[model samples]
Target: MPSTNRRCPTVAAPPQPTDPTSRKLLGRLSLPERRFVADALRAETVGGVLLLVAAVAALIWANTPPLAESYQAVRDFHIGPAALGLDLSIQHWAADGLLAIFFFVAGIELKRELVAGDLRDPKAAALPVIAALCGMVAPAGVYALVNVFGSGSMDGWAVPTATDIAFALAVLAVIGTSLPSALRAFLLTLAVVDDLFAIVVIAVFFTSRIDFLAFGGAVAGLVLFWFLLRRGVRGWYVYVPLALVIWGLMYNSGVHATIAGVAMGLMLRCTRGEGEERSPGERIEHLVRPVSAGLAVPLFALFAAGVSLSDESIGQVFTRPETLGVVLGLVVGKTVGIFGGTWLAARFTKAELNDDLAWPDVFAVASLAGIGFTVSLLIGELAFADDPVLTDEVKAAVLIGSLIAAVGACVLLKLRDRKYRALTEAEERDEDLDGIPDIYEEHTPEYHLRMARIHEEKAAEHRRRAEAAAGSRIEGDRPA
Candidate 1:
């Protein structure tokens, strides 16, 4: 009556000690931060799809009967302060204004990687870093070779050097592949460095003249901005006007105004302070990224990617040296440059691909790197500004080249995805259904002999306890 046959209560197991170094090696973000990144990535994927749709819609509008004139009118419409020589067309505003937001997001990502992510360790980051550099250089070289004396100015050599990370990642996500996370990490690091190189190229080579007065004003503003950030000034009221002043000055100074975005992003403090729960930089990025991805990029793409192919003959469009060069440089140059760079580094250094990846995986990623859209279009505009026909050709070529790269990457990555799924299935095989895989407990060889022995001892002790409990139950029943 008093529950004489009641079973003994079971004690809960203590939590296992986690290895901090292992977390570092895995490069795992904290739960909240990881979720933030995931949300940002998902937003970017959606943005990429929207960007594609905008570009396509623009092209359709440019070629269609009634919408063509309106589209052209909108693209040509200019309304800014003419006193400061800033009254640029709608297209120019999208490029010089909205695209600066995109560059700001890029700057934050680059800084984050440099400070806390994969690029923190030079040795750990060497492969992708070197590959990105080589990737940029090779494309420039290829484009130059094809267009040296053919037709267009060689200033557009940098046109095909960029890789649009958002578009590439969006394509990968659409493929629904189950590849290792390392592949995504490598792509991101490579793209960040690639963007850095592209920015440097734009600043150094593209600037025909520099106004020292304006430049000095920009520098002063930056200094003030830095000083305020150091003083923990968090209000947008103080920073917004200052930032606008800097961007305007930088634009007048013949340096790209987008550089201001990068400078401000880099200056934002990322580490938490004593009284703060979150870093100001992270909060700012979180606030600004949706604006950048959802609005700025699509707007820029809508303006920049509209190439009216209504009049050009097939032979003329395809046979132009600039078009040929840009297409080949994006498709062939990027693939060879990134893949070859990675291969050469692996051969020379002790660095190897992750166990979950192979050379084929790297090759596929290299192909994905060729999806150079937004920045490629911007560079095309810059490179062939004097040649309108060539500019349109370059835009069309970017679309074609990116499509080729996307298709190739999807096929290769999908195959790799299947392989990973098989491995995951094997990894999850648990014979006893105890939530612990027998494979993990039994697969340790001599290197993990101590752990194996401990596991065996624990198993035997569990068996002994179980046997004793059975005997105790039998004795209690007999006594009753």
Candidate 2:
């Protein structure tokens, strides 16, 4: 009785070290995140195309002999209540007011990502976040190096540090049909983080003078905004006026007014409450994103991208140190930073590249990240506000750099897409011969029923053919 022994319970083996899912970068996204990303991509793609058109129109208008004066006059015209210190030029209104809307949408997406999307997980967040940081830093470094050795102002370093998500995604959507979904997700995340950093750079580096009273008022308004939303207060009439006041205060405060939009967007509740169909953030984002994409952004591009395309201006892009720096920083630095950073993180940290992606896919996306159109132009404007000539040159450089990146990315993405398409076709063929594809394997019963119906029809056709053949033979034998 004293010698009784107890049997131990079995323990399942831990997942193998070689398991593909562990620590992978750009892993499968949740259904909601996937849908959100897809919708955002579609809108951004359209917006990007519109932005491109506007930019082209602006360039043409600016370069034309008769239209150039009219374009300049229109952009320079002032409107807004002077009592509120808001009498800004049409160009300034586009840059400050409309871009705030764009930033607002970005803030909502960033908040959602932090609260519920991939960024919620530190492991999942590391790759894109790191890559984005490196992407920004490398570009700035390149710009700095160029300016240090040449006769150019260093103020435009941050210009090349920004990546325009809309343009990059637009190019990808056009060419990456058969490419991995993970690549799109990776690019989106990288761009979002890139935007956050760009916002910080703008606020920190670009401020003119301190209007502490107005700045304090803006902060108080932000606090009130957070308080109201937390109290479940709802109404466009209430928040709209408050937001406009805040934006005005922020604009008057000498800090970039776009910061106000992002702040309010971040404060909005992201998680859905009970009995709610969507979160306040989601609903507001749904309403505002279309405006930001379709109206705000394109208008901003129209005003911002109207640089002269004359031979002299074109020559300045390559000859001027600041403009040349922007070009190299975007085309060369972004690619090296993102791709090299990914490799480093995967090698040193627990992170691993997703099995569905190769280094080439990452390289392609990195090249796409160099499309620093929208924010780059904004930064260039701020950097050279005193020098119209320099600003024009910088804008031209941004366009040229972005074009080169887009073309390079297109070539690379096309190759990757072709490879992926071939592989997909092979898989479809194998699946057809071997039974239901893995995607339909979940609907096993329905698939089985469908296959059963198909087999039965085939069998029925064979039976009819056999009966006809026998009848023919019998008829021949009897009639002869």
How does candidate 1 score on lDDT?
A: 0.77
lDDT of 1 at 473: 91
User: How many Å off is the CA of 365 in candidate 2?
Assistant: 0.7
Cα RMSD (angstroms) for every candidate in the order listed: 9.9, 9.3
**Sequence-dependent TM-score of model 2:** 0.87
Q: Model 2: how far is 12 from its true place, Å?
A: 34
lDDT of 1 by residue, 13-73 (tens): 1112223443222232333433445555676777787787888888898878888889889
TM-score of each: 0.81, 0.87
The runs of at least 3 residues in candidate 1 whose Cα sits more than 4 Å from the true structure, single-residue gaps closed, are 1-40, 149-152, 274-277, 310-314, 420-480
For each candidate, the alpha-carbon lDDT, in order, equals 0.77, 0.84
Cα error, candidate 2, residue 65 (Å): 1.3
Question: Per-residue CA lDDT of candidate 2, range 393-469, in tens?
Answer: 99999999999999998898886564456434432332324453333233467666666777898899999999999
Write down the worst ten-residue block by lDDT for model 1.
Answer: 9-18
